[model samples]
Target: MKASEVMADLRRRFPNEPEYLQAVEEVVTSIEDVYNEYPSFEAENLIERLCIPDRIFSFRVSWVDDKGKVHNNMGYRIQHNNAIGPYKGGIRFHASVNQSILKFLAFEQTFKNSLTTLPMGGGKGGSDFSPRGKSDMEIMRFCQAFIAELWRQIGPDTDVPAGDIGVGGREVGYMFGYYKKMAREFTGTFTGKGLDFGGSLIRPEATGYGNCYFLLNMLATRGIDIKGKKVAVSGSGNVATYTTRKLTELGAKVVSMSDSGGSIIKPEGFSEEQLDYIFELKNYYRGRISEVAEKYPDVQYLPGERPWKHVKCDIAMPSATQNELDGDDAQALLDNGVIAVSEGANMPSTPEAIKKFLAAKILYAPGKAANAGGVAVSGLEMAQNSQKLSWSAEEVDDKLKSIMKNIHEQCEKYGKEEGSDFINYVKGANVAGFMKVARAMMAQGVL
Candidate 1:
């Protein structure tokens, strides 16, 4: 199938859903040549089927707030594909959650999971329910109501949901508790559970830690040391905070971190002590990232602008939301002597930005390959729950590092140009993941 023709068809069908269309386009374009070699796939129209989700479950969540007021929110679970294994992905709870966004996420998750060499397929679910400013009781009520409708459709072997943007340990606890009550048997139907339960150790830091590990692997190919490298990172959430912490441990200066209100561009980089304060500020106080500037004399907070605007580092990690970095942002980064980018958030860069990064031949890594650490660890969580045992922090961390190295190797193997040393990791990751899923789908028949 022609990549342009397929994308045009998808665009016609999904006119206003730019996110979903962009995801499908990226994958097909990268692997178009490989896909063309499979005549049976073309005869069966596997590309089209792969682009569409297997099923989408939509429902409403009704909850009572602390003030005795009732609220309604829409919930969704897009079980995109399960050719490799059970449905697996995170459930987000933010005002921005929608079909297009979740569809893109699930599509990315499928390949991301495949790259992990785990027996897992891709899926994504979430609701447009902002957890911000909600009381604990209110959030608990909402979680319960959300799972009341979702529990019947999910199980350890059916569909496993984990935490995402607005859903964290607290939200997972509430949802898991409600699911246990509704389903009547306690099983590992969800991940990111509290350690008292079946949650895996190092799961919280898996994504960030894995991202840094992947970066090390990429840099190692060029014999570059990570120490003393100036970096810029976006987002103040689990991925960003832990990534910053890991980089600091490796002697890299992370110069920026941001949240909804704005970003903190610190030319001097953040000390480990400073990151600890940010952890409390965001995880406990639920305060804006602007608070970092307020607390620190050396930090600069740029309201209404992304950290990419002020980035002057060798590496940029857009760990925030989708499309947070655009073409202009990418150009600004390139002009500032940026040489590498590793996405911590799903689809953080737009098509235009990705084009510029590719055109400039920078060492770029997409979220699916670079940030699969969280889900890779989640896959480990699944295995531990199945074995009825837990691994030590060191064991889990070693396994995560190995998995990331393997992912980096796979990308290199598939992404290397015929004569050039530069590797197109996006193309490598997409092709590597697609070949696996496509073969799996072909073997499984038309389900």
Candidate 2:
């Protein structure tokens, strides 16, 4: 598990694939303990096969905006691996889309899907087109254009896409509508659809609620509870909002929340009414977090700062974008006596930040494992689609809760072996995910 050995092998095998290189590095780092434990994984050349994606598709999406100006965007679909089943992941619509990021996400999705123990493979697709501030008609046009090409590459039995960062319920609805029109099928080819369609009831809250469920399990290991604890959460989107709601429901006082523009600190705790108003501005009105301060003068808004820095909390959840919390932020949270950190977004913490949290012995949960709920529920959606039946909201929520608990147990089972009381979630997630795919690959034999 030496870095030199890993780098050498990776370079020799995937000389031109930098995405493969980055992914291999992360996978190796996460499961170095597993390599040390087994050694045969290296001997059998499993790393080489796992490093290469099963398939990669890139295309151009040309759409006309409301102004009748045509815009060109790059689209990607990386089917990282399909050993378990069909490709399953979200289609992110952001200006930051690229092959490297998609490859990394698809690679990560492989394990994330595996962690759910569902019959799903790993794949992701999207365009480098941002949907922010676009008119509903413009978005619909863009979605239609995007799906015109993407529909040929995906389906219910082949690859299914849900919503990601810039993609939401509205986008999903548009895309699904376009797919239905183009394919002349009412089948469920996507998740996160409107409830009127095949969408699950708790899909919006799945990721955040699942993350809290995992954190609760982590705390339970030490006989700790979330009741009456203080929490600071970043991001006002679905993940952060739902995390706040679930935490509040569990008797936690979430005093801080933020958006991309700025952070809001309410020392008295954020009321559900205030949160609903914030959601109204951000989600409905598509405004900034500063609007929260304007609406409720009681809430103090801090400009140009992360919420974690100003709030002292027992739990800190970075549900924001990737690497939003860095080393300094981790140190600040640790110094402020934050007991636990769970990522509700992919790779929300930088390597240095995670190292700092680990060094401080804080309970940290990585996004791959903690935020798998969205994809897990997506898999469930797929099941319902295939079975031509829809589960009730309560039933879906019960299933989601059970899956989160199982994921936590799996993490603890593998993470506790190294005498780390807090659990090495990275190791746990990677090992658990790797074993399932590894076994499937072995059974498939040289594909």
lDDT of each: 0.93, 0.85
| TM-score (all chains, Cα) for each model | 0.99, 0.94
Runs in model 1 with CA error above 4 Å?
Answer: none
lDDT string for model 1 (1-447, tens) is: 999999989888889888999888899999999999989999989999999999999999898988888899999999999999999999999998989999999999999999999998899999999999998888999999999989998999999999999999999999999999888988999999999999999999999999999999988877888888889999999999899989999999999999998889988788877889998887778889988888888888899889886868989988989999999999999999987899999999999999999999989999999999999999999999999999999999999999999999999999999999999999999999999999999998887
Q: After superposition, how far is residue 375 of candidate 1 from its true place, in Å?
A: 0.2
TM-score, candidate number 2 = 0.94
Q: Which candidate is the best by lDDT?
A: 1
lDDT of 2 by residue, 1-447 (tens): 564687797688657666546555767787766666666666667766676678889888888887889999988888888999889999998887887778778888999999999999998888899888789898888889888887877888888888998899999999999998888888878999888888888899899989998898888887888998888899988888888888878999888888777899987688889978876776677788888888888999998789878878888889988778988889889988988988898878887888898777778888888999999899888888889788998998899989988988888887774544667777788888888998888778777
Show how many residue pairs clash in every candidate, following the order shown. Answer: 0, 0
What candidate 2 gets wrong by more than 4 Å, as runs, is 1-3, 8-24, 36-40, 418-420
Please state the error at residue 187 of candidate 2 in Å. Answer: 2.3
Q: Report how far off residue 122 is in candidate 1 (Å).
A: 0.5
**Clashing residue pairs, candidate 2?**
none
